[model samples]
Target chain A: MPTDKFQRWVNDLQKAQPVHPDQTKQTILSAMHPKRRKWPWIVSAIAVAMIIFGVSAATLPPVQEVLAKVPVIGKLFQSAELTIVANAGKLQGVNRTQSDNGVTIKLKSAYVQGRTIGVRGVVSGIDDHATTSGRNIVYHLASKSNHLHMNKASWNLQKDHAYTFELVGNVDHLASGRKIQVPLVFTKMFGKKINLRFNLELKAGKPVKVAFKGQTSVSGYRIKVLSAENFDGGIGSLRLRVTKPVNERDYLFGISNIHINGSQKDYGLGALGKHKSTKQSGIYEFQTVALPKKISSLTFNAEVADWSKPEIYALSELPNQLKVPNRAAMYQFQPASLHDNQLEFNFTLSGTTSSDRVLQNDDLPYLMYLQLADTKREHAIVDEYDTKGIGKNRIAPILYWVESSHHFMARVDLSETPFKDKTLDELELVVPSAFEKTRKLPTITIHNQK
Target chain B: MDDIILAMHGDLPALEHLLLENADYLERTAYLYLSNDTDVQDAISDTVLQAIRGIKKLQKPQFFKTWLTKILIRQCYRRYSKRRHDPILIEELPVVPVAGNELSSEQRLDLLAGLRQLNDANRQALLMHYFNGLSILEIAQITKLSPNTIKSQLLRGKQQLRDWLGDDYFAN
Candidate 1:
């Protein structure tokens, strides 16, 4: 059987000499070489003459004025090395360190903005650093009023003596313009723990309201943007209200292609809250970055059904990876490992599904739902492992998954499903379907609050 | 291949040899992404300089080919981004035979035209897989994407190409 002439075409393309390889090599090598100096004495004389000429050229008022006019050239002349120092903002340097058993933790810089508090530093003084199964360091931010911690606040030590430490955690729960004594706590290092406290003057920004007057309904789902606010640390929030939420095994259906001032902004996981009376879910999530200071218009595009329902097949029918087209986006599902009780798979999404090319900085979370049936019993696992409300499911695909400039990659764990009890021969994977039309909401304007 | 290990230890001659040997692969890969000869030349030069400067950072010497290829691809991306608005036309190049042993001249043109319709990432993925005979995992490493993503891109690219060149030309 012919494996498609496309493969044959590609094989033939290997022999196609689009560009002369040797010619390219020669050109590159020639370009890389510095121009040769014909004579040493002449070269030295020319260098001295050029230096004298350059001095006179610099002193002349006309040259100075022309150089001044070109500020970029003037900047180049001002410094031999071009290093632009950024304004570190109002955040002060803690410059604190803790030393124990020759291991030192140095606090380099700290800043507080809106709900995000970022800290950068270095851990040094260890002669030989090893990564063992149990030898791990955990960090947390604790204050009298607020407490936040990350058990897996991991850092990798480079070839250099210092271990790079950078941490950014949201502090939206705390009040702005408040002087808070936040303690930086560390645990489980060399069988010991350490604590460093810093006095931070936290500032939280007020969010601008994003009130869309007319709600847009798509496939029985009503969506509207409630409010948007700019916060410190280049963080912004968009509060959303969704009627009749779509449930997933791991995470909720998400919104994408959020354009503010005609530019799409990456979105993080929005905090989901269900109203006690109406049961309507209000999502309070932060944008990947802050919005511009002012906006004349804002548009929100939500993914109603991003993925197709799971399609089940026998073990023999399943390829290593199955690619299915969903409108503009192509979803590829690759089975990583299958066990009696657990199934793991990786998925990739590509193509121009939205107007905005999903940037590398954007975080796209996967919500996987798994259902398995066999002769003995039927089992279903809705793995909303991405959402916080579901369980202790802290399996963030954003951490393991990659959102490349070209596509999105994610891995799913379905160990808790009923696959463990079934026979090895055949089973069913429930197809969880989602529609893929990005609904652009009506453009709206919000007045600034006094 | 020992040149990679020698180059990792700051051996300039070995590094030069390794680069000269892989020049064809780099040029072919760069040409697929970039049309302009000047950009292709510039990308190769830059890739060489970056590879030399960043060799110590290479974790494994065995992956030296893929590492060099990755740097070259990134340089192609940079060139592509800079020259996006003002694309250097393929008409500028001197005439070269597009026809191969199996593909006719018209079919070759059709294939090239179809490739132009695809995005830069997909085109590169296809060329890397079929032309260079790189596995999905190798392509994944070079593209800095998951293996699954590379497989998807290759499959999608093949489908798009088949769509353009007629289904009869690419019957399964």
Candidate 2:
């Protein structure tokens, strides 16, 4: 009843402005008629054909050589319109103009960076003061059928009905020299739609050399640093293969203490996806914070926690006790309560001692798992949305709140665990170990195929 | 869902029908986020145009509602960012009292004023939950946050409102 009351209040508030369906429908239809009727499909087809042609042409040896020589300039050649203008040595002639219903839409310039295509152009039609109309001008990056829409750029209208628009869209993470189709549809209120198709070639930058590749183990967990690339924008993409099938939890805690060129940089638990062929391992994808300087021989470090080891405690050991020490801190754990397949624990972090020092620590450091006292099934503790007052989903099993600098209270709900209502075989407490190691990865060069 | 597919194929009537179906919803969502009448109207208009333009990319027709909601939210966020430097326009709205409802006009105003006082994240969580009647997971997907985060924000926001409206306001 209380919930219903809140619902009623919300419903009442929503009624503040009663929208007239017919009037709104009429307005939308009026805006759609001039634009949606004549164009879209044909333009998209032509654009696709152009992309095929452009892509085929880019693969030639001469083109690759040219692209290699002018990497910087190639980035500036974003759109087909711009590419033509660039090749012609006339940047000013890049503008492709189309006039329909007394308005002209011009494609002034475009360029592709990676898969992202950026377009800048102008729309000149209509009164200057009437530029900010209720009717929107939509720009489709691909085609109506393919449904690629680019919404990044804003159109700033100047005096005299002249509007400058910049649009950017991505072509599904394409590589350099690949070609993509972009269908630009300009629709204004009461004006016929203007469609322009462009087959854009991706500016290929030299692939960043993979400086390191090797297999290593940390805290009993096997991991392979498949490859690491140093790309523009100070970002580095690392491909990894870990012993365990990486889950969402791995994205938050799989990697830690990452340093590049012996200098520390901000890092997150990297994303791990299923290997194309096998589920036994996953492809770990993650990027490090902006590199401080050019990388020579880089060092990689992380705490790959092994939560598989189960520390069994009998019912007689009510309120089981466990302690695990990492490099800088000792983790003290005590089971507080267990019922209905739910478990709660009190964890205390003993600060660094003279013998060991942890560079830094996470506010919440432990990942959780559970097994029924009677069954062998082990269920990972996952972030539950049903629980109220949590703004973000907890992909990791560790549910905790800091009680003090060294004290934390944690809760685990086994309802969704693998064992669910089943009797537990044992309760396992998995915590990160303090053992630390840094691996100097060997560089592996990637040869570009001719 | 069918409407979205038809609209993508350049069916004007389907497009019109789809826009009409979500017209009230768009206005309410925009109004809640922008808290300005003019901005709400503008956002709704922009949402319609953008939705139609991008309809072909809707991928799955079943996701139409969520997709449309995401678009309107983007428009509302844009309007909010643009008006951030200006003082919140808490324009006086006439009370069209709901029949049989016990909440007084002053109380309603207090609730609205309290809403305006809350931060954007908290306010949005509450509005999405209550106004849109979306599940926590749905809200999380739209906001690109974890469901737990949405739940916590919702709880904190509800508490803040309860604090302002009196603890007994929702008491059974």
Candidate 3:
């Protein structure tokens, strides 16, 4: 542990230094001026106005373009994500509270044109009496400005999603019985698009976690099963959940949209990934009766609402690999005959588009090849009836099978316990087009159909 | 206010006592950062003057050394930036007579050669730890880095120092 090379190195540095014994105490003060002082505190008083009023430094004269040219310093500043401090006008004697320190820090944009603004932080120090202006709140309109780059170049919805923040911290001075207040106004750089459910983890500090199940709208909307004839559009709700990423923070909830189409419905804040409403990957469309409002926010263009199209198919994507059982638990489904006295709805990759459809397309196969990976089981293209409407034939239920390039068919099966199994984490489904002779195609779900 | 004025003018005995205790350390700190120059004294003197003027602003006086040293370090960086040099190498230049005292041989030979090779960040970390004697936590607060980052730098700096000083020279 005691290497002499290290010790000598430490020694050499100590030896090569000098001492300044004479220059110990110094008394220095800046030139006093009245107008020079009133600018900073005044801005802090109007921080809320500044942020909501949109008076930020957006107008800075092409900051990134001009700053990109300054040799070394320009490169540094340009490449940097700037988080410079702006002056928040003054707040004098506002009946200070313990948790209000971060809020008290005055904030403002650097300039009206958006560059070179000032930020002044006001901490009330004891034995410190500011020059008596006519008003008790002697606002520091101008602040000492410092430069920072924009939010990090890589910061975005994926990695770091930054949002505006208001922080307030106050703790009492134990010795003097005076309170120490720190009112900081700064933008927080969150790595993700403020996903309260996924990113806001409960670790140590207080963080707000929010999740919602429906869109946070003034009006509460509900999803109703409409008659197939009257089916109009999808309803949406924004669901959100908030968990403490830090310890002891409060939970929050917000809505995104309500009862959107299964595919159009965006996921809540609890889970991570590209869970947005606009994503069109896995939505199953159904008929919805029109509600009172005709904003058409609910109407999507690609929806197959013609009702006359005969090739009814439930479409979903299959991942490259299927997850097998790690450790099997509980009992298997005792082999039961699929249908009995009740009408059995067949699950198929290809099927007649409507119940009234008399002729099926010969170009497309009437059934699709279905396979189970865990048990090398293969079912032939057949007509299976589906009696359970709640049953999403995502894995085993063959909603519709493509028998050929154009012909469609449906499968009829009696058993329906696959989705109800508590042990299954994921199930796989494949629908191969008959004419392709190779590629298994995908199907889109048509809801509330016979 | 008058006492503050007295302290500022260096008329107060308290100033002298503080000098006797810490002037040597901060001077060496200034020389290390400012790099054995004439202005090193002035910069250190300014650091002291600034600290004295703002001592009331210091909530934790026990950490006065690190606190004042932080101010000195900032001044050093600012001055160095003003001079437009990135990692200023002081020993390559002719020596300027330090105003107060010379460095100890143990300090001079081992630390100077080792410290010159360090980048601004590592050298600052090393000096703040051994010279100004700041803890890892305090160092983190000043450097705005996590504790582990500081520890790794210290380890790397110490290793580099050993490699340069030759075997058995600094054996402890």
Candidate 4:
């Protein structure tokens, strides 16, 4: 029989089998029910007895102390390691509540560790419709002297009306053990604006800065570790310099699996600070997991990848498709036009092979470096601001998957680049590099000099 | 769709109705990944529990079936991965039902054996596309793969099935 016949046979088998079996439905329904049908009377009797006992137990100091010690932000730290850190930093005996327009926002606790400040709160009386809309409540933190730049915030509906929220971010400048008045602003809460202020004492352990000079070579690229710093929180920064290559093509360097004092935890290193490159060498800063108080050594794996040669395409070649060299992906460009000193176009990078991993939004920038260059060797690479969509009226490269087309839709803005003023006719599109095969170098360990 | 919206708002009856409506699809989809009847039932149960808990987080109401199938597939894969490490006795191997109306018991057994020979990704792609009548894009969404990958998997899966069963097993 043909495959279609097989499919039909399967379909027939599926149809012949009884759907909505009574046993399965009963099992699911019983699971869905709030209370079990079996032993209902016994469960209700036990619940009533517990309620009376709980009212009696609530007055006891021991029970009250145990209840108070229960972590309010326990759900925020799901991992055991993070839970330990959170419990150490958990604030005690602080409850600030602000209510307006039938909604209540209670500031439960806030802690400052290193440059990171975490705020946990509970929200109540929010509209259920708004919650079901799956839109986050827009909020931010403000202070007179310091600005709290929230990097991560999440809220979970604990019950019918209670929503637990946690916000963690790096503060611009926070003095250790300083009391600061922070006004939390909810710019949009289901079309309503609410603002609440709480007095928070910023207490963080002293930061330690260590200077060291060590060098390692990977794939001919010489890397020098300039310095390292550890703050109160297990967050630190590493500064490094890489000697520039004499060849026309450059190499993109990446570091991962950073270990401190031979710890198993991979203190993942992420690029920090602005990209600074000179003719001689390139300086890079990476955020790392801070070393413990008595740190001895640091180790990390380096990845080196040769950048693809710059491919200059004429403006007339718009609406063309090109296969990425040494990669299973296709780059398709739509028609390009200049708009008010900005070169705008929609392009898609789609996978061409089964094994090829589709590029996510975060991977788009690393896929290639785009630039607008003229006949003369002048070009402007996309800066950090352009990629982050920071400036007003600036359309930062918007990349989203188009379900209908089964490909990614990306709108990149070249408005703020140095080539913004250049006309499309005179300027050529330059793809400085598309990512290629990466080779991981052996882990380099650097011993600290006491 | 109305039931999905009501279910998202914590309507238990609406959620149960939706689950019952797609009960067979869920069971069959789970069975494709798991061979044991108990495992299939457990996968379905866990999928139902997760859906009931995370209904409000479901963004697209129209893709309820796809969302539920994705959950069921994950549960099935979890069990499948766990079962890989555990030792199984010869008697523990599932016996394929020999009674069928559209095909003889031998043919059904051969089909099941042939499908079992394919890799997990290819088999999933084939079953989701051909047996479940899901589009390539839908399969990609369910499996979190690119549509091109799904298409390639389906082609390779059909070829492999043909190689194992016979050249005429699949129509040109």
Candidate 5:
């Protein structure tokens, strides 16, 4: 067998020898056409560069000049017509569907607003559609003190999908050529379920046997927890979640911190696009538990503050490598330290008269995050985590990934301003993804928190 | 004596002869790239034709080998792009046996199959290394990469080739 293998290898080595053939220079001098190959690459690059920056460049004058001859190609670029009507108002050129440049768009919305309305229309034209070039696009709302709200939380669409929506309005400020990527944060469900509503209380200690029972008008849930660390001195929050059905629509529900019954530090965070809003993310689970309930299902519609007995079993947390060692993380406030003070917060869920159920997935947790925004003001690291309860009130201690055990320090004087009620909307769940489908072009309907 | 004669007289035809002599290796590069028998020949013919017309532009005679390598690689890419009508299923091609490092006709076809798994740049880097016997610096010059990058690519290519050939194949 070895001799047979040696013979086969010897024959292969001889066959693999380099074969040299002769050639002449005259035969090589025949093919020459540099003009044709280099131009297309240059043209494609110029078009891409022009589309990247807002200003038009030298490489694409022919695109602008020849656009006048193409009717469908011209409309999406040259000019857009704007008109406005109140709820049950007139829609001009009702059936006039137009295609311009490379964009084909029409107003398909028959629904009107009884209240003040705001919607923006953006277009990407021919030089874009004819050639596969990305365009510079963005959008901004014109109304100040306007709530850019949506009609529903879940809109029967998957992520990364784009639909062309056109709005004709007297507010010409919105019709500018701005391209924006869709956010992957929220999805719209059926009817009108826009943002989420959360109810949390910052009590002193853990409650015994906490039982949360309610029937949701819609199939949805939230997160709940007990916070032990206050900001600097007077600022604190008790986090929680109502875990239940989760789907694309659940992400659209945004939560706003209403108030701390008596002691809120007023963080002055009432601005649109600020990150200090509702703390629900579609990432992972905030800890949750379900006890036997008297009702078939609970409506997250009710949020009442009950602090009758908050201290049940002492907070006992899971020992994790992420935690600091030898330092007592969880703190207990003395009942005698202050007067009877309770936090009162009202959370509202808008969209489709709050009767939408197009989304139903009871797996993902509806989470609530109480981030310690300012720890530098206070000089002590209050990193704590434990679940303790005996009856109707349970406490989940504040948990954070502090530095390694020896180098961890937390400062807790977070009382310059306390928690006030905020609003969450369809835009809150979106405006973060890079696709074209989840663009939260602002609307004008202000969400009410009364 | 020969070094002085070559240094002073500097034979241009001899230099041209060297590039033309390596024409077969350049054709093999084009063939490996296009994978089509007809397009490979066309790319080789076009590379030789372009090289002759632009011989004056080849002023740096020392870079002739790398320059010729670029010509063939670019021609192969162009012809490959043109003839490519999206890849088809393997079943569409006739059942030709692959080349390998063996004596039989089937062995030659098997070795060609092993080359297809590499991305274009890796395949070109390997060809310039083994088939053309170019140094890492020379291969770097043709591929427009740094010498260290070429070294890394060669190291990675050897590991990848070993993975394809398996342990028993390389052990002996």
Candidate 6:
């Protein structure tokens, strides 16, 4: 049959030899069953022996001291890269185990400071083929009242198909020396159900509240450190408010170089939480590392994009498509249509660099702050926009690569910003400068903390 | 079918057996999207890893091939998107083995080149429908497009291929 010939051609196409045919399966198996490290097993053995002999280990202060010094659960904290928790002085050893379906989960240690709670554990007896992404495994830690607010959790695969896990969160109404029953549940592990609960005796300490009233102005932007709370194990939360120019088009792109204790070293800020922003100012909360017991100093820099000197081009004057030069790639913007208070553009990026370099260097989307402004220079309120599946939002543009067409696609929507009822002829598309000016603000130091 | 069940129950040997059974199909399907042999191998390895990890989540064991094919396609697209800028080397093209077939080696090369020229959607639709022998509904389910859309794409893709290959090519 005619179709049979085409099928033969496709079959012939599939006869290509794989580059690493001999080692492909073995490589995959090796990844699934990584080589076991010797130290963790030794640590596990020593800790297990202590647990077997020291029945009243918690009651005995000396035994508890030894357990604290070499806790098996400490391995979980170390595996998670939470050095603060691993080196913490107040870690309490739980050393409890639950087993089902040949799988054993051991809760090793926990700590409570203020409302913050940290628990570390290990899961063993996973099949070698059960090599799923760590993201698929879900761990839920809750109390009977369900007031335990989980902040962060991580699980790392260990040798012998085992996994070390860590959980950090905040709990409400946790008093010092109060005993709480914390139930840790693994809803599904390798398609099996496993539930483990532990009765934890909480020895909570209060997190010191540091009054951070520092403000600095740089490049027409005011950055203020509102407040901060210092928790045990060098974990802290810093709240900041950045006030931008009243112009809606002007944007405070980013704030970085956050350092404390007058040290030049950057401690690296973690996830941002509780963000409230408006046209004028934005309040941000950040989880930081190595917050000192005493507040000495705090410093940071703010980057602001000043749109006062934007290059204005009329909608009629601009071409249908134009190539803009970029560092790692060339950006092509094809203006599709401008009708009914909506303007559309197809943005494509093409480059001859590695994917990582292209992804890191492609900043046209951030600099492509196209806005529709009237002759009076009043900008329109951006009502809604859709980049299809390309760009994420107006501020943060996440460009998705189109597999068929070797370029990234972004569709911009500017309908309701300055004027909802203005014609295309009466408005001009404003293009902001591609570069943001960074300014270092004066360091603010705190004094007289109890 | 027993293998699927055992694999779902965290049996490593069973999972390995299942992957080996479908290895050819996975590699071939990935080759349709990626040109590089190394990329195709990476995609296959990723498919196997993901299949082993997520086999238990497969509600219907009968759809194992379909599930594995979907994972392979995703991995192929990921590599394709990442390495799109790399120049395609002519030497890297697969050497076609001559067999007792109607189409000449030159004609086969033309067909492969024509297939590559089609857009991603049309090419995927044509390959899945004709090469993989997937029904329109199955293609729609896998591609997350409507059945009607898949049908149109298949029709358009076949027409485009016919136009490129010419009437004499298909008449053989």
Considering every candidate listed, which one attains the maximal TM-score? 4
TM-score ranking, best first = 4, 6, 1, 2, 3, 5
**Per-residue lDDT of model 5, residues A1-450, tens digit only:** 113332333234335423213221222222233344356435534543443332223221111000001111112321111122222132212222344333433323321111111222222232332223211111111111111222111111112232343321111011011111111111111111122111111111111222222212223343322111122111222222223343322222222322222223222111111111112221111111212222122111222111111111111221122111122222222111111221111111112111111111100011111222221221111111111100011111111111112111111121221211211110011011111111121211111121
- Tell me the tens digit of each residue's lDDT in model 2 across A1-450: 226666666555566434434433443454455466245334433543454355435532110000000101101112332333245332322467777666777777665433234567787775433455522232223332211224244456566777776554433232333223444444332233444443332232222535454565444445665555543423345556555434422321245455655544543323322222122343445544333334443445443333334344443243333444334455566645668866566666565443322212221322333333554433222222211112122212333333234455555566664435533335434333322322222332222111
Considering every candidate listed, which one attains the maximal lDDT? 4
Between candidates 2 and 6, the TM-score winner: 6
Candidate 2: regions farther than 4 A off? A1-3, A18-450, B1-5, B8-10, B57-63, B89-114, B133-152, B167-172
Model 3 residue-pair collision total = 152
| DockQ, each predicted model | 0.07, 0.05, 0.08, 0.05, 0.04, 0.04
Of the two candidates 2 and 6, the one with more favorable DockQ, higher being better, is: 2
Comparing 2 with 5 on lDDT, the higher-scoring candidate is 2
Docking class of 6: incorrect
Query: Model 4: iRMSD?
Result: 24.5
Winner on TM-score between 3 and 5 is 3
**Model 5 residue A345 distance off true place after TM-score fit, in angstroms:** 85
Which scores better on lDDT, 4 or 6?
A: 4
Please state the CAPRI-style docking class of candidate 4: incorrect
Better model by lDDT, 1 or 5? 1
Higher-TM-score candidate of 1 and 3: 1
Instruction: Give Cα-based local distance difference scores for all models.
Output: 0.46, 0.46, 0.30, 0.55, 0.29, 0.52
Candidate 5 per-residue lDDT, tens place, B1-172, comes to 2322242245444434554566566554555555554455456667756665655576565766667777777677676545444432221121222111234544433344334433345556666565545677766665567998887776555544433322112223
lDDT of 4: 0.55
Question: lDDT (0-100) at residue B6 of candidate 5?
Answer: 41
What does candidate 1's lDDT look like per residue over A277-305, in tens digits? 12233333434345666655555544433
| TM-score of model 3's chain A | 0.14
Write one digit per residue (lDDT tens) for candidate 4, span A1-450. 225776765655455433335445554565566467466434444544564356435532210000001111212222222233465554423478878777687877766544456677887777876566533233333332213444445567778766787665544332333333344544234334555555554444344655554666655667776556665545666767776456634455667778877889877635542233444455555666665555577788876555445566765465488677677666788877767865556666666454232132123333433344434443223222221232222223334333334344344445555556656565555554434345567777767664
Off by over 4 Å in 1: A1-88, A125-159, A172-174, A188-215, A218-220, A232-234, A244-253, A263-280, A288-294, A304-450, B1-172
**Candidate with the greatest DockQ versus the true structure:** 3
Which regions of candidate 4 deviate over 4 angstroms?
Answer: A1-87, A90-205, A210-213, A245-252, A274-277, A294-296, A305-322, A329-349, A352-395, A401-407, A410-439, B1-172
